[model samples]
Target chain A: DAGVTQSPTHLIKTRGQQVTLRCSPKSGHDTVSWYQQALGQGPQFIFQYYEEEERQRGNFPDRFSGHQFPNYSSELNVNALLLGDSALYLCASSQTGHYGEQYFGPGTRLTVT
Target chain B: DQQVKQNSPSLSVQEGRISILNCDYTNSMFDYFLWYKKYPAEGPTFLISISSIKDKNEDGRFTVFLNKSAKHLSLHIVPSQPGDSAVYFCAASEGGAYNTDKLIFGTGTRLQVFP
Candidate 1:
């Protein structure tokens, strides 16, 4: 079983440009969460989606938005990106209402120039 | 302020030795604690977790201990091997076995098991 899958292993974008990252949840899972990991730092929670609606969000700004489709897939979008936005974007999937470990994807490296 | 903290930036231990990684948190609301191992260029992998009601949880050679009063948690690896070398992160969640809670992660400690 494919645990979790993310698209665009790496990406390069200019400042002020928008970028989108995609993620497919693990089989039998419906919740998707996005995280950003900066250099020398741990993964920071961005937001979590369930039932195609955002259930919770972290301290990130509005520029960091996301969408959950009916297929249990997710998309993370960053608008007007800044150089500081460069980081590794990770996607994690878990079953709703279950106390289990989250399955993480390989992550997408975003470099904002 | 960092809600979760792994003070040790790196540690080196000989093979077949015990590797203990420690973590501390400032949030008392956190009830679920987890440890994750991460390799370079990959996402953090869930290692083990302990609920607030439990003081310790063990799986194979890995064990996690939690101290509710001190807000401290630790991961112990017995007879550490070379393959165990990786960055270890401590994460916490507020609602334990109740609802969906976002995970807060620490800076992480890099463990290197040498031969």
Candidate 2:
């Protein structure tokens, strides 16, 4: 079975630009969550999507948004990117009932120039 | 504010020894805790976890201990091997029925196992 997958292994974006990263959850999983890992730090929660609707969010600002398709794939969009936005964006998937464990993808590295 | 904290930024242990990585959280509502291991250029992989109901959970050579009163948790790896060297992160989430609860993570601790 295929695990969680993310597109565009690495990306470079200029300030004031916009970027969209994609994610495909693991097979048999329905929930998708996004996280941002800055240099030398652990990942911080961005938001989670279930049933094509956003269910939970973290302390991030409005510049960050996400979407989940019917097939359980997800997209994370960041607008007006800043240098601080440069980080590794990770995607995780898990079943709705099983809240404790989440399988993570290799993540997309976003470097804001 | 960082709800979860891993004070030790790095640790070095000799092979075949026990390695203990510690984590502390300030949120009392956090009942679920997890540990993840990550290599360079890779997403973190779940290592082990413990719920508030259990003080300890073990899986093979990996074990996790939870101290609810102190708001602390730890991951123990026995007979550490060189391959076990990686960055370890501690994450916690509040009680919730769905999988939407956001996880608070620590800064991370790097473990270097020497042969």
Candidate 3:
């Protein structure tokens, strides 16, 4: 089966602007989680959504938010983007409340100038 | 604080040899652990996993060993292949379901296998 997929494989934005990244969970998956991976650094969790509602969030600021639609697709919105926000934004999908595994998407590379 | 840790930033091994990647977690409550392998420009793919109750779990050329007392886990790749070269990530979760379990990940270790 096709795995998780994210749109706008790469994007360029300016500081003080807003950007939205999109993702579609893998087939048979319900929960979607967002992660930001800086260069040469491990991924840090942003937030998780299940049943169209956010369930868990990380230590990120309010400027980072997400939404899960009824189709199990999701969107990540960052307002007032900063140059530091430029990184690989990965989207992962797993079965809602699953104990098994999580599948990640190819990720959207956001570059802020 | 970073709950999961992979001290080795990179490792190199000759093909057909064994490769061991180490990971230590500070959270004692974590009961499940997993390893993901990622190639450049791609997302991480699940390699193997082991529950806290078990000491070892093997899948073909991959094996994961977990030590509850030490709060450590290691993945052993036997007879490594050139295609196995990638960044490996260690992750852990606890109390799955009930909105209690969230997978915490560590900084990845890059592995290079020379043919």
Tell me the TM-score of model 1: 0.98
Q: Which DockQ value does candidate 2 get? A: 0.67
What is candidate 1's lDDT per residue for A12-90, written digit by digit as tens? 9999999999999999999999999999999999999999999999999999999999999999999999999999999
Q: Candidate 1 at B71: error in angstroms?
A: 0.8
Error of 1 at B77 (Å): 0.2
In model 1, which regions exceed 4 Å deviation?
none
Error of 1 at A48 (Å): 0.5
Report the Cα interface RMSD of each model, rounded to 1 decimal.
1.7, 2.0, 2.8
Clashing pairs in 3: none
Chain B only, TM-score of each candidate: 0.96, 0.95, 0.94
Better of 1 and 2 by lDDT: 1
Native-referenced Cα lDDT, model 3: 0.91
* Residue A93 error, candidate 3, Å: 0.7
Predictions ranked by DockQ, top down?
A: 1, 2, 3
Which ranges in model 2 have alpha carbons more than 4 Å from their true place?
B96-100
Taking all chains together, each candidate's TM-score versus the true structure is 0.98, 0.97, 0.96
Clashing pairs in 1: none
Question: Where is model 3 chain A poorest over a 10-residue stretch in terms of lDDT?
Answer: A94-103
Give the per-residue lDDT digits (tens) of candidate 2, residues A12-88: 99999999999999999999999999999999999999999999898899999999999999999999999999999
